[model samples]
Target chain A: MKEPLLPALKMTLLTLVLFSGVYTLAVWGIAQLAPNGGEGEIITHNGKTYYENVGQQFTEDRYFWSRPSAVDYNAAGSGGSNKAASNPDYVATVQARIDSFLVHNPGVSKAEIPVDIVTASGSGLDPHISPKAAQLQVQRIARVRNLPLEKVQALVAEHTEKPLLGFLGPERVHVLKLNIALDNLK
Target chain B: MNTEILGVIAIYILIVLLALPLGKYIAKVFAGERTWLDPVFNPLERLFFKLSGIDPTLEMNWKHHLAALLGINLLWFLLAMFVLMNQGWLPWNPDGNPSMSPHLAFNTAVSFLVNCNLQHYSGETGMSYLGQVFCLMFLQFVTAGTGMAAAAAVFNAMRERSATHFGNFYNYFLKSCTRILLPVAFVAAIVLAFSGTPMTFEGKDSMITMQGDTVQVSRGPVAAFVAIKQAGTNGGGFYGVNSAHPLENPDYLTNAVENILILIIPIAMVFALGFYLNRRKLAWMIFGVMTLGFLLLSLPSIYSEMQPSPIANQLGIDGSAGNMEGKETRLGAAASAFWGISTTATSNGSVNSMHDSHTPLSGAMQLIDMMINSLYGGVGVGFLNFYIFIILAVFISGLMVGRTPEFLGKKVEAREMKIALIIALLHPFIILVGTALSAFIFYHNPEIGWLNNPGNHGFSEMLYEYTSAAANNGSGFEGLGDNTPWWNISTGFVLLLGRYLPIIGPVAIAGILANKKYIPESAGTLKTDTGTFGLMVFAVIFLVAALAFFPALALGPLAEYFNH
Candidate 1:
């Protein structure tokens, strides 16, 4: 192994410069023009900056809910519940969420709940929910905000993102963007 | 048809379409043939060689190549250790993260250095800017380039020509970086940066959520790190949650691109082998076997995950959206399930969904993929794994046919046979033993704090860790609270053994076979590239892997699956 030590050392040093120094500078330079200057796309509202992508906690009836987060939407760090699909504790947690949803919205039945509303997202910071999930909460938001049911439904329709190329991915709605739109509703 | 299923199909089609041209380019780069990139990279490569005072064209044998590989890797380990252990006070420590403990540093440094990024330490709080960029990200490029160089050396020896010299490792390594990895990574990084994967030096930003909770959102030079992490099959994440973090994989479109990045290099490497040896049929045969193995594991996972999660089903909550536990709605369960199989198949461990939280059947698929890891495999090492199986297949077939076992016209003697069998058996031996030891310790002591889930699922966590470490497929059941010294140190040893030995074994066998006199093909000679031989190799792989791993799998994922 020592046979190539001299050359290996010199090679390693040069690669450090090539990859860490030069290659990084190249990517960093391109990032200068990226959205939000690659700091991450952010939303500036009232006073604070919110990561447009990172999900925020939105359990209030007036707003559409983000997916349940095991880490409770901790953007400082991210994780999942990591509970097995059959873990009893995890099952109970999902049951509690459903019960809470029922209390919050007497109109919606258990069978109407989208699974996204019950499952804790892997990243805990997932900003998007399936369109069905957002729609499930539309009636609750309409009731709490004193807005017409049609108005809230239209709001969900407006924010609902279609799959790529009209048919390649799951259709989802960004919870933060939709809620901000809801708050802006006249 | 399900749009998410279409999305998975589209990604697979794109992978095959993209891999062809990239594979040809990779072959040209290693062959030292001129291409469009030569004008750009030739001067830079010369500059590197000049600075190092090394000859780029120096002919090296197998031993010389191994010496160079180990030599540089050792230095890389030290550099990684120094940076990781001292990231707290490092120049680019924007987040003010603390340094890792000695044992953690040892684990992390060895993990990334060996190209298996089994990160017990999460990226959000554990690493600084300098550590992410210089240490982990830099290792991603070179470790991948290093693996490719080793593959090129093996490819060189296996060529029809009787060459005493294996190709120069530096030539292959430099070209792999500048031509193969750098160009693709640059474009992909730029794409990801625009797609909200952060590429900045900014520290964590504090923001108030809609619910009036103040939270700190961590951002970094993540686009740069993530691009290579996927492309190089390193699978380390800049975030604690890997690709599941919204910033790392912003949306479905970005998710597709990132998923493509994982398989592109690994698949291209298979085609590269074909182009290098001028054996297109042989490469296709191998690719076919790998793809068959991949689909066998993946399709069932996709179907299983498309069903409702146990929680949703037991509660009778409408789960038309499928198993959403630990999965992003943006990626969806079908896409996530497909990704789980693909990532494990390629030794690219980045996850769009949590494997630990997947449906038990899907979880089992992920485990089995890692257990039989040669399906389009890791960056350069995938073919190397398949090569071991091929050697075994040749030996077995020869015994049945009553002829001398040979591959590429070289005799499969006792020395080569012993090495191949050891390499084949070594993967499962380490994984099982490590899992058993951890299981025993947990059973006896029960206070070591390793498992996060309860009962059989907990055992899967332990099993997944050792399998991930030993397979050099670093995706884990993160449910395993594995930041402790026991988890780190044990898996670190497994990671090193898993990566280097498989690589060294194949290269040694190929090197020995290459130096022997080349015999022209005769009517009686075994045709190793035929469909029959491909089936034989596939059988041998399943037989060896299944024999070694079945009991352990039954104990872990399989038991968990049926219990539910």
Candidate 2:
């Protein structure tokens, strides 16, 4: 046992150098070649900078609402609420979200609220929402913005992203992008 | 079939192809034979031994091996706790993440030390760069090395007869880290980084959204961390979303790479056993049985996940594209299902899709995989788990045939049987009991609320957490609020017991058998390496897991499935 200790410590140090230093540096070098030089993808709009990949909170009546964020859309820390379905508090939170949505959109019925609209996304930074989720909020946005309903509907269609290869994942809209497009409307 | 499904199949095939050669290389390394890397590593290994005052010739009995393993692990646990708790003052805090709370630090320390890597805290916010590199990644290597070393001790014990001393634990541990884990992790990290995973120390960067809103985007040494996380079967992730994050898994190619890396070492270890024992046919048989079980569970999960969600159908949406909720678009349904089963099967809990959002039957399959975790489990320890089942099968079949039970030429006495039974039984004992206790608490105090989806699905979430902990598979349903004190402390104890006992039990049994007088194979002896024995072991695994977990399954995912 005593005989192997030195070797154990030595190996630990050697591997630490290899794994913690060399390997990390090699990866960093490789990441340098990736898009944005491994930095977060930045999008500029109206003299403000934003991460194109991350979701932004847009709770206004005239804007498309992003998915509820457990971390309040703080991209610095991303996570789900991790509340099990049976937890009464979580159930109430979802219920509250539903009630709030209903109050905001009187024309939409309680059953019309999609699951994504009420439940927080796994990553608080999920940028996209199901097209259905975006469509559900259409009435409220059109009413609040005083935009033609057809015009808002056309914008939703224009911004919708199809599944990869046209058959993978659900059709979805990037809420930040959709809201930006909505703001840009003449 | 779609290209996506075809791509997944191709990757699985590639892993098996790669594992065959990798297994041979691993066998050569452990056996101390001349290998291509010997020139480079041999001198380094000798220097390690010389500097550490290790003779390299000393061997230890089972007790000493266990002591060394446990002692080193305890040391690491303390060190990790210190680093995690004091990270606020420690270096590399560009993001200024605070030290983990004591209970969470305790839980995280134990989780990584046990090779469970079940994270109650999100990596980006909870840990600093120093914590990620020094504390978490460091444990990933050592804990995985400890398990492999223990398995190597068992392998040595089984190979030698009338031997009181198994090979030195330190030697095995060092070799596993240097020869197997480090080399693979080095290459994998580079691959992941090139595929867009960040490997920088820079803190969170503020970016503006297209909507002109500012978002603080977190970045870290994710690529390096992710490689070892999957390779070591330590499933903690750099981001809260785990492999679901684009940086951690940017595209289908990277997704396929991560998935294969998760299963490669565990799968290869099976073949390594065959090479070490000079019993190629036996290894193939065992591999076949494990693969069969894996396919049986995985195919159903894939099929179920590709079917539309019942809720989606009720909403009158076009359900033709299947359940894409909580899954990345690049991975889609088939690849996600494959990853779900592979990760759970190998006890590598990194995920490209959230298990919580899986359809009821797919979720049940994930639970079943972890319950019977021996389907090519984590690295070397996977074979050790299967060995427990093999012993039970030997005893039961021997009783049926009216003969004395023996394995590998050693008499399987009551003492050996007792240890094997304890190891096998302890898994379900902790899982079911813990689930029951949590369920009871949830029932009485709904106000203590941790669940997110109500009814049967809610019950399944609790069951999945305990099962993941007990199996040392760290994947969760993600709907459970597990950071609370009740979860942190409870699962910490479960993780420690689940990891050490399973390892110690199998190694001890192997050691005791190695010291017994040799009994050569005879007509009366059970042919353990045969196809029939493999089938018996398979049956024993199913029977034990089914008997222990069936009722729980009935209440959780099963009920949810049928209800839909």
Candidate 3:
């Protein structure tokens, strides 16, 4: 043990420099070629810059809502509500989300609410909702913005992203981008 | 039936297929055979040994290997503590995250050093970029190398020959990092970066939402951090929510990559043993049992998660979308459940969804997988833990057959059995005892505010913390609010013991077995690498590890499951 200690100290330093210093910088160099320089996909619209990947709060009646966030879409940090699936209080919170949705979109029934829209996402930063999740909320967006229902539905369809290779991921819509498109409509 | 399930199935198939060759490669790397990577890594490794003033050719017994492992680990721990404690003052702390509290630092340092990586603090606010790279990510690589090196030494001992010296620890350690972990992580990191995962040194970026609110989006060298974190079977998150964070795991492709990365080496090491021992059948048999165990745990969790949870019905909410309380819409419920089991089984505890929010049955399966670990397990130690179970099975079956037990023609004596038994029992002892104390405190002082949810689920939270600690499986019930001194110090001890004891006990047993006279195989000797023997090993794991946790599990997840 004593004989190995001197070497251990040196090897620790050597590997530390190799992994944390050189390897990290090497990866950083590779990331330089990535879109948006790997600082997250930032898009500017109407003179405002927003990260396309990170979820944002979208509670206004005139826009499609993102999933409920435990941290209120606090991107400086991220987390889930972590409410137990069977906890009554957690169930009540989901109930409240549903009731609120029904109030804002009076034409929708309880069964029509997609669970993704009511339950909190794991990251508290889920930018996308299921395409169905986006579809169900279209009527409200149409009513609030005074647009025809077909026009709002078409906007949702236009913004919907296909699964990777059409089978590798889920079909979903980025709420921020879709809402932006709705705002830009003439 | 959906495309999401296909994505999960694809990663499962991809990793096993990839692990087959990786295992052979790993065996070659440790056995000192020539490989394609040698031209690149040989000179680099030589330079490392020369600068460290270490002779990589000195073969020592298991004691020396253990000493070498512990000695370097101690130094690494101190270095990690220094970095974490001073991370605020360290360079590249762009978020202005403060140095960790003394208790948090101790817990964080010990947790990562042991390869458990039970994070008590959120990464965005709790850690500096220096801390992310130096303190945590560095440990992810080295600790995995340490586990692989220890297993490699054990492999040398298991070779059907009498010997005192096994192999050089530093050589295997260096080879594992250079020839295995580093190259794979480099490629995976690039994949992650290209798929929208962030890899930058900059601080948080202020973004204006379309709704007129400014939000701070945290950014760092996360792709690189996440790559090693998963590939090393070190599940520490670069951000507070782990892979759930969009920047850490940006999409389904990156999620699949991360999942595939975590399982590859662990499953591959089983095959490495087969190659190392020149027994492909044994590797297949072991892989078979592990896969059966994995399916038994995972399929149920997936089914449970996909069902509309009773809570949804009770609250009159729509049940068609399954339980989505803490799952991402892009990944969906089935994929998250699959990940929950995969992460716990591998001891790579990064989550794409919150385990605390999983339905009762799925949550139970996660705990059960950790408690009865060694189902394709974590890094090298996963096999080590399973090796202990193998010895116990050999001894128990020997008793049934009324013949002295021998593994690979080496006699399994009383000494070996005692060591295996103790190692087998230590995991449960730490987890159960620690939970009892924490639960006692929680019940006595309900206002401590440790639990975010009440009743059975809260108890499940306490149980999950200790189980995660003792199993060296570091996913948590995130709502536990467990950064207080009691949770931190107690789990710190569990993490240390849970890690070293399993490594020490098995290697010591293997070392003893290696010193014994090699007995020739006979009809009287019980065959270890057979299907019947695999069943016996599974039974032993069930009887020993799984049964001990039944009562505690019942009180938590089982009770929750049966209610309503």
Candidate 4:
């Protein structure tokens, strides 16, 4: 055991220097080449800076609602509610979301509510919502904003992001981007 | 294949190339050979042994080794619990994160202690920075070291001509940390930090979005945490989204580095075993079998995830893009699917994408990888798990040939067989029983509401959770509300039982075999190093997993796959 000890410690120290110092510097150097220098992609609109990667909170009926956030859309700390489906609190939370959606949009039915809308994403910072989630909220946004239904529908279609390579993920709408487009509507 | 798919393939190839040299270096480190680092580490190692009162010359039998492993683990569990339950007031908590609930604390402590890292609670809000570093990060080093130490002990026993004692547990443990895990983790941590993972202790930073709304951003010592998280195969992420967070995995290069980090040590350990025993052929045979299983599991995942979602087609949406519902655009579908398979196969549960959001068949593939569990598994323990199948194959084949069953010149008798069977049977038993109980509770009590999606997809989530816990793989479906007392407690027990028992059983069997009378090779002797034997071991693994888990899988992922 003593025979192996010295070599082991030497290796540890050397690797620490290499990994903690050199490797990190190398990786950081590469990251500088990445978008936003790895700080996160940022978008400036209307004199405000927004992290394009992080989810934004939108609750007004005039704007398309983002998915439910466990941390209330806190970009600083990301996470899900982690409430098991069996927990009464989670059940009530989902029910409350459903009820509120129905009340806000009289034309929408309880059965038609998409699961993604009522439940929080794993990352509280999920910037995108499923296409169904965005579509379901369109009627409410059109009514509240006094926009024509077909015009708003077309906007929803325009905002929808297709899965990568046409077959990777489900269709989704970047809520922040879509809402920004909405505010810009003539 | 497209460039994305080809890139993923190239990455797998690179892991093999990197692991080969690492394996040789590890073999030398364990054998006490003179190396370039000997001058630096020798004095430090001597100091550790001297201060701790561990005799470098001492050796211990299997029972003593097992005792040392469990005792240290229990101590870690207690320490982790104390830190977690008191984290709110503890130092380094700039976020003022509250202390964990009792059940969650218990689950978390046991999860890390066993290297299971089955995180029921999110990292950012659920734990303070002190708790993250002291409890979780500390366990990452030791637990990984513990598994490697145990495997090294088994190697010692197998290599000896005739000896009841293998080596000192403390010595092996220390060596594993200093010589292997610490070095790799150091480099990995730096890489992660450089790639934009936060390495600070600052509290939440407030930022105004383009919408003119103020939002709080959570940051902590994520870079350091993620390094060991991947390298140690601990899999618990600093953030709730694990590797999916931009800070946790900032870009494509970070993704590639992390995926390679997750697999390098586990694959290297196999080569280390070969080098230690001077059985390079046997090592290659084992590596071949594992790589085959890995490829079999990974390809379908990529294909399934690459296909357009059938539901999207029904909605009149283009199905040209692959499944990306739960994936980051930086990683794309191919990389995400590759990670889905790699993470589960290695018992490294860090995810760049949500497994729950994958296409039904892709979800099933992830579950299958965990259920099989030994395809290049977590560090040292993976080979140990596969060793059980190897023994079973040898024994069955020996019986068929009307000869005595022997491996490495040691006869496989009733006691050895019993332990092997117990270890092999225990995995499926825990997974199936836990899933059955959860499903029963979900069905009998309508108010429980454990299933989020309802019907087939919901059942798949429950199955995935239990399978992850039972295999000590720790990745979750995320949609399942699992932070409650029931899940925390149930999975906690499964994590402990799953991690220790398999380790103890295999090491004990190795000790027993080492003590048996050695038999010289003859014409009738079954050569385990051959490709034929590797196939046999592979078949036995699939057969056993199929027998025990097929029905349950059919009910969950399989059922969901067909329904979709």
- Winner by TM-score between candidate 2 and candidate 1: 1
At residue B290, give the lDDT of candidate 3: 91
Candidate 4 regions exceeding 4 Å error are A1-73, A79-186
DockQ of 2: 0.26
Candidate 4 C-alpha error for residue A106, in Å: 24
lDDT of 4 by residue, A1-186 (tens): 344344434433343343344434554455555455545456677877776767788888888888787667777667655443333455566678777888988887665665566666556666776677788888888888899999999999998876444543345688889988998998
lDDT tens string, model 1, B5-39?
A: 99999999999999999999999888889899778
Which scores better on lDDT, 2 or 3?
3
The TM-score obtained by model 2 is 0.87
lDDT tens string, model 3, B331-379?
A: 8787789889999998888899999999899999999999987998999
Give the runs in model 1 whose Cα sits over 4 Å from its true position.
A1-3
- Which tens-of-lDDT digit does each residue in B174-277 have in candidate 4? 77877887678777766776666766556777788654578877776677678888998889998888988867886667788899999999999999999999
Error of 2 at A56 (Å): 5.7
Model 4 score (lDDT):
0.79
lDDT for residue B471 in candidate 1, whole number 0-100: 81
What DockQ does each listed candidate score?
A: 0.85, 0.26, 0.82, 0.13
Whole-structure CA lDDT of model 3: 0.90
| Candidate lDDT (C-alpha), each | 0.89, 0.82, 0.90, 0.79
**Residue B200 in model 3: lDDT:** 92
Q: How many backbone clashes does candidate 3 have?
A: 0
